[model samples]
Target: MKFSRRASANWKGTGADGSGSISTQTGALDKAPYSTKARFEDGKGTNPEELVGAAHAGCFTMKLSFVIAEMGFTPGNIDTKAKVTFEDGKITNIHLDLSATVDGMSEEDFQKAAKDAKENCPISVLLNTDITMDAKLV
Candidate 1:
């Protein structure tokens, strides 16, 4: 199977003075604004790292759902947060925090599913940075 996603950005002016807007094919980000200040300073709008974190969190959560289901349990709720760290103009780490509720499942099993999701998710597989996860059954 194959799938494709697209996003576009348009910028004008210097790196420190320029501004741009980003949009995705799905319109999830319809011409969302971004700039050097937005990325490096406390400015409005979204940044690249924020977008990556969102993608990672979404992918890992979905993968965890499948992993839990395969283990013969129905998941109640899964909340995941992917924190992307950027330093020295490079992405340093991604930390995934997952909290889940599953009926009749042990904490050990839930951790296993979360770990499996972190290891097998498409975004996790594609990223080259350090990825760690803290999973809890709640």
Candidate 2:
């Protein structure tokens, strides 16, 4: 079986003081606030890179939970944060921070599972840039 997902974006203007629209093949459309200030700030609106980070974070967490379960451990909570850095109009680095609340898992085992998740997750495999992961078991 083969599957693919697609999204499209229409951007205008220069690096600063421009605007754009991002829409997926599913017909979900949103606006993008173009500018260093807007992107660095609260994002007066949605932006593409932010959404990519969010998607990667969520997918990573889900993958973490699944892997933990496979190892006979159930997670009480899994929190993940993804940081995407853009350089030269491309993604340069992605940092993943994850924390897990789970029983029956020692620090060593938990860290191993988290690292496996980071290394094996679909998003991590798909990204061409380097991905750094930091995980804590609490």
Q: Which number leads on lDDT?
A: 1
Per-model root-mean-square deviation over C-alphas: 0.8, 2.6
- On the 0 to 100 scale, the lDDT of residue 36 in model 1 is 86
| Local accuracy of candidate 1 as per-residue lDDT tens digits, 24-138 | 9999899999998889889998899999999999999999999999999999999999899999998899999888899999988888888889999999999999999889899
> Can you give the lDDT of residue 76 in candidate 1?
96
Clashing pairs in 2: none
lDDT of each: 0.93, 0.82
Give lDDT tens digits, candidate 2, residues 43-118: 5667667887988998899999999999998899999999999888899988998888999899998988988888
TM-score for every candidate vs. truth? 0.97, 0.80
Candidate 2 error regions (>4 Å): 12-16, 25-37, 40-43
Give candidate 1's TM-score: 0.97
